[model samples]
Target: MWCFDNQKLHMNMAILETQSEGGNIRDSLLLTCQSSSNLIFGIQPKQEPLIRSLSESELRQMPKERFNQNEFSSIKLSKDLKIRKEDIILYNRESGILRDSLEKDELLTKSEKERRKTNREKFKRALRVERLHFLLPKKEKNLKPQPALKIDWSKSKIKTNPDIIKVLKSFYTNRRDPQFPTGNQKLLLEKLAPFPIFSVENNLRQIILAYPPETYMKNLSDKLYDYYYRLYEWESDTRATSIGFFFFNPEDALMYESTIWKYGSLSAAELGTRLSFFRFSTAYKLNRTSPPEIRFLFIPDVKEVGDLVTRYRYQYGKQMKFHPNQKITRDGFADQPIYTIENVQLKQGLFSRREVSYFGELKDHKYIFFTVDGAESAWNKFRQANPNLRLPRRPNLLVYNFNSFINDCEMDPDLINQNFIFMLNREAYKALDKSKQDTPKVSDFSIFIDNRVKPQLFLIKIWAKRLKLVLFHAPRINEFPRREALLDGLTNFFPPSLYRVK
Candidate 1:
């Protein structure tokens, strides 16, 4: 079945090949796998014909030249597009006006003139707005002149100080929260425009990581995985909730903690108390914090089981339907008429189970989750082949203590208390224990899986733990389906080539 659209790249070539000689097709694939040094597998011999058919016999015979031609052509085309040498079409306001005046001398209808005038005004207005946004400062300041009635968008309650709004507005426009926008925060910001959840978690993650580098790294992984797992689970509970689903970045929590650290001089207990009050109160008034729309599943033809092999349908569903149990009805995705296949691979020798999972989606995108199967079960054989192998932990969330981090600063002895050192080690111990499963208590310090922006949060935990940061990320969904796909895809495609020496 060939999935074709007017769009060039949307051409999906599906070739279901049958062997002409019936010479064990599996052996051919196995031969290719061995000869190619495992660079090629998951690809059945049936799929090989598709590639072979695309190549000329001469090209196939001259593998070296063929490879070079493919590489050179691809690189040259991409480079040409990026650095195309062309004469610039310069347009000057004065020259355009002069040309228009000259054209008017030939002929001008009253309606045409009026339409042109209206268009000119509209263009000018748009230009004005663009310039205004461009000139706006990229960094947010704690202090800014505010309207007489200042209100924070997150919490609509009137406040004497309107600095938070100023901060948010800057972040919204610049895509950066200047104060605590570190490396992880920057990555979250980059992804926020495409996936709004990054913005939500940005502040929350910042606070958790501010604890201590060592502790945060240890516990952040599992806690982060648990966060998304819960949200995906929630999507299955009801469509209404799924419809209103949103995401936040983990770094935002860190940003929030940094703000408290920099501006407020209160103890950890006081800071936690103040934050809890502020969060609850603001949530009531402003309805400020909500997840962002990460992806949408618009299934126009889900009525046919066969049509389920489209990538676009899967992409939309992967973003929207977090839990496999959360069934998206055919009627739920009727709005978008045009559809394309987005994820059409297998996992464990079968198409992914209908169980809704964000990790499933990530994996589909990154890895070709395909395995061989036939009359005898392949899973048993594969397991027997690697009996001692164990799957790596999905990912973990780490929480850090802020009080401990500041104490390590070279000047901390003069400015802040060093008691945080002991607190951080204790928290780190609790987070790293594989046997511990207690929900974090709301004491002087608190940590939990950030439901929003779980992958970004998991990555942050990975980075922090590797660096021994004291932050605990709450466990969320194990792996975002898309993320797994991306990681494995890179691994499969980006391998080092081995040369045979004569």
Candidate 2:
């Protein structure tokens, strides 16, 4: 084999010679030697051929030298070098280069050499930037910006239990319900099973309708709580739920979408605690006797609401059916189809948190195809009926336009098939995206769905950690009170003693 040994070359050969009876030249000669890397051969014993040393240029003509002359040159340097042409041809292989049918022994041009040099320079610059901007600073703690979130009452279009209404009024007004009045002086909220002031307009009939299903509102409250505890000091501040709430300043609204106002740090537990507060399949409680406070509060981004709703429908609407008798059920002859309880499965299933979210399976796809307007309306109704019983108000309200979503689905994967979060405005999401882009090296949450693990289960765990609300939608029915319902409900209701507020 051709190789550099002490920067020299050598060869081995066997030959048959007869002591001359008289001085006479032989008829032929036998040669043996290595051809190239990983090859060796000798002339056949019976086939004696003429052999002679080759000049440097002549040796360069050999096939082995045509590709890697530097390697084959080592062989030529040896006085002992020897080989048979047949064996050399048998071991020949191209040196990963092509030049028509015949091989050539030529060096690459200077331009090709320069191109490689340029690539190496680019690599060094990239390495330097990466070290300074990412690797070096990763160990340093990140600074958090001040927290800003919006909190307010929104119009509801579904039935609300009298007790929950009383609780909300008490919390909002900081006062108990009024004493009995002689006439119709804002009849006691307790007397109304469902309040009318919060009604919404149905896109189809344009009629003021009651709120969504009971469970829907309950899930909404769960989302609020999920968001509420995202603060770093929430647990220490509020021993009851360990969640903190911050309101957005009026001045901040104008610049809400800016990156300067969006980034902050709160413990992962804070978000998890909030998500654990709802009625996920059932409910889950944190194991600690005194859990950490949650960091909650962030501005809402309304522009993203449609995206959030589309995701909700994809996860829960696939198997639902609308019944005509139900409030959300549609009447004959319209551009949109209505959904109701009759044709849906009202089962309590885990949607996000460990606690189960209340959901129903629809029996028809026609209802879903009508549009997101109808889906939004039906979701409102769905929320009103299920009244998760544990949570206090409607889950976060998400309005969507189906036609717009389907048309734009190809542009954004999150808008079409994944779980989404709603912000009060567009700026919040923009700020988040910018922060992530600026620090491209950060690791993100991911899930692997396989035989032993489900993607939804991982999503639930992550949702809890982020203190984010989730909604699932599908072809037939839309799932409500997502991850918030599961994690928050379980965490809030767990260990019973924590329920006894200090």
Candidate 3:
């Protein structure tokens, strides 16, 4: 049944091809009907014309050039001439339809051609409108507005710590203290602006809470001391002495003493006694003499002290009165006399040097003057007299004054007496000036003081077994200690309330 149907379909295709190629449409239909009848009747069909398939080479060799009018007429005249089998098949399938359509159009009247062209344009317009309609709803859907995004404020909330809040509140409350100006409070807040306030507050609170009050207070005091210890004003000044006084109880002084020792020298701890003196003075309204008499003797040059009387007269002038010549006292076994200079009145009582002694009573006077060379000579003679008695070698200050000062103060007891304050005059300024020249950008003199002077002062303190005298070196002529510098130094250590001049 399938084979019969297939044969009948092929016969119909042949009839269509024949009609499309200019064969008689009626005759082709009759042939197809007869073939179908034969298939249905079970009669064997007659042999149809054999159509030979052309090779690819033969099909490619066919001429593709357009024909002129004469050539076209010739092609029409030879319409019945048989070409290659493939050519016939190709023309019957596709090219034949196109050729027939062209020939039919040529035969049409002008009015009929115009009518066909208009119909074709109308059909194209309808197809384009249908396509536009199909896409219009999709474009409108795309152009429609989307819903606005809804924000969740809760998700963007700022995180805060309770401890930080507590700390901030404490600072704010303290800011209202009568001691601090509102302007200063604002300035402090501005300084703190760059820091994460909450984070710092939280960390500080945690640290403070972690330690006991005593431990925490001590730690804070230590930190404050370490920060300011190198400043010349703080090294031996009364303000530095007063720092831990208000913060610590009298009973805790020993603890503070031990703690301070761990950080710096014994001299540094002794400086705290200045606070005691301040407390006494404030409470009693009278200066306390509990602090030893600190006498500053400025030696301009160490080499110029061969004859004490002669040098004193030359330096201070004849107007200055000196004590009558007296024999220097010595220990019972010593052959040489101990060096002493007494009662030298400068500028008619401007201020007087009551006595100058080498290895003698250093606490007996408020002022003393002695040359470094003279003191060394006296130390050598005294050492020779008592062979068993040991004395440390004298410090050499000629080459580097400041360095020598530090070394001697740390090593030599004679240099660091409780009652004696040694002031290196022009030599100190020269040394410091030279250092500055070598490195001009050092804005902080505290570094130099710490690295050079403080260690010697500390050594002197240990030798004296008491808070040694405060040493003041002249920075310029007639300006041994700058009062302004001292006050400014106080500002670094004390709260504004305490630093107020009484």
Worst 10 residues of 3 by lDDT: 197-206
Better of 1 and 2 by lDDT: 2
How close is every model to the real structure, measured as TM-score?
0.15, 0.14, 0.13
Model 1, 394-446: lDDT tens digits are: 21111121112222332333322111111111212222242134333343322
Could you tell me the C-alpha RMSD of candidate 3 in Å?
Answer: 48.1
Ordered by TM-score, highest first, the candidates read: 1, 2, 3
> Least lDDT summed over 10 consecutive residues: which range in candidate 1?
25-34
Per-residue lDDT tens digits for candidate 2, residues 1-502, read: 0011111112332222222334331111123333232211111234233344223343222111012222122122123534321111111122222432221223434664465446434433322111101100011125221111111112111222234554454433312113222122122112222211111111111111111111122345444543333221121321112222111121232222111111111212222111001111111111111123322222222223333334443544534332332222122221112122222233356653333243435322123222333344555666677666343222322223322332233244443223221112223234334435553442223212221144356556666644434323222244344434434544322111010000
Please give the lDDT score for candidate 2. Answer: 0.26
* lDDT winner between candidates 2 and 3: 3
Q: Give per-model CA RMSD.
A: 29.0, 34.5, 48.1
Q: Measured by C-alpha RMSD in angstroms, how accurate is candidate 1?
A: 29.0
lDDT agreement with native, every candidate: 0.24, 0.26, 0.28
RMSD of 2: 34.5
